[model samples]
Target: GAIVWVHASQPVQLGSGEALEQRYDRRPGGPRIHSFQVDGGPNRLIEALDKLPGVIAVPRLGTVEEDLAALVRRLTSGDPAPAVVRVRQGAGGAERSSEDRTAPHLARLWALQQTQELRAKRQVRDAVELAGRFQLVTPVSGAVVLENQQQYDAAGLTPVDPQTVPSIPEPGTWALLLLGGAMLWFGRRRRPR
Candidate 1:
């Protein structure tokens, strides 16, 4: 599969104190639109369209000012933002504005928050997978040979020894542990005093 590298430059602080940036991909196809977001200090919530695959390499673009500007224009020009536009209205009265109407700005904010939460969950899952992989021994000889031994002897290399080991317990083990702990607590509570 062809890999796309989407890169975001260091965010530029806007006049309104919001940091903005353009994320672009450098694949065989033209640059793809990633996302933009308001900076709520260091841990700003970023809203993007989709997640990248493991093998994809997204190279960051140097200048994000143009992209940021474009997004801002699109957002403030009365055209609703994609993710939270539905929150603004429902069924029959989609066009009717009400006092309780959720502004597009607020909807965008909520969407950004949701996006950040999704990103965090993905990071946690990735970390857990990496931790599990770390416990297993990987063959490094092949990688070293392919990287550094372009002209060196490749036929006399000894095969890597395979160590037989069981895979880690499924995450269901954690759920069972929690369930047991809850049951123990309830049993204790039901006892005298």
Candidate 2:
């Protein structure tokens, strides 16, 4: 929903005049990373989106408006792809140079596993991994929230095979209307008698 900036690791200058995202460091005096600003969530909402496949956005019907929720795909970045290493036969195909940029995935986990506290090891690793996964980085996933359709004169969005937004009754108003109708019916009956 907002532009978020994260610092890129391992110093490497981006190609001059590169397009895609406009890098920014909203934090004062923070290291600037490549502006890979994707449509991501902020905080808890994003957290929920990241963990689950999707989140349902129920419509707010306080105003009795006909609102529509459409399925739309948002553009966002996911985890970086791993480098594929291939072997070359000797002379004709020798084992080519290997560049292992990433640390073994399980090293930290193993370290936590080896701690003095045996029972705490798994818990520690799990907690650490989860934190590391969500920390700082923006999480992207399928999220269904009340569609902002009112903007642009509320006519810009057209949901495919739309479902009608049900009209929900205002509690006090409905009760009062029913009471008034009942009183009128009773009064009419008395006059006839």
Candidate 3:
């Protein structure tokens, strides 16, 4: 028999309508089956997963390592997790008051959930550190530094100032100035000795 590795971060719940079973695999690389007669909501599942070491329980959409770390810190400090859990009993008839009281319980459960999340984050950080030590990758284009006058001169590249306003000559401005200078020079040269 071929052994297949499953790398999912969630536990699969089995059964249908009114009869549900929550399964947890505690043994390393082993199959597991669990059946219980209790309300197994997300909070309950998260609480259970938190008890298992190396088990990281993330939401369906997933969360970042930083956020998970912060959650862990808060949970370790006896602070409540910042997650809201809503439990509803029945479809449209009288709602059960017991379900309404589960909110505070959910908050407590979140703290436990964060413990597993934190462990997973630590594992990821350790793995990253280990991998970085084994390989050193450098930029192919090399370092980029601010181009100073010395650097530009060395590289033979001309740098222009874009803020400079070019001085424009008036219509026949240069010609008029040159003509005036010539008249003055001729008058001076032709002066009686």
| Count of steric clashes across candidates, in order | 7, 5, 0
Q: Tens digits of per-residue lDDT for model 2 on 142-181?
A: 2233455564336554442233222467799899999999
* RMSD in order of candidates: 23.4, 24.7, 30.7
Segments of candidate 3 deviating more than 4 angstroms: 1-7, 10-57, 60-63, 85-193
lDDT of each: 0.39, 0.34, 0.41
Cα lDDT of model 3 by residue, 84-193, tens digit: 54434555766656354444334334433443344334454543333333221111112224468898788765554433323468769999999999999999999999
- Candidate 2's displacement at residue 94, Å, is 49
Q: Estimate the lDDT of model 3.
A: 0.41
TM-score of each: 0.18, 0.18, 0.18
Per-residue CA lDDT of candidate 1, range 69-164, in tens?
A: 555465457564344333345558665454555544455454444443443444444443333333321111113233334343565444332342
Q: Between which residue pairs do clashes occur in model 3?
A: none
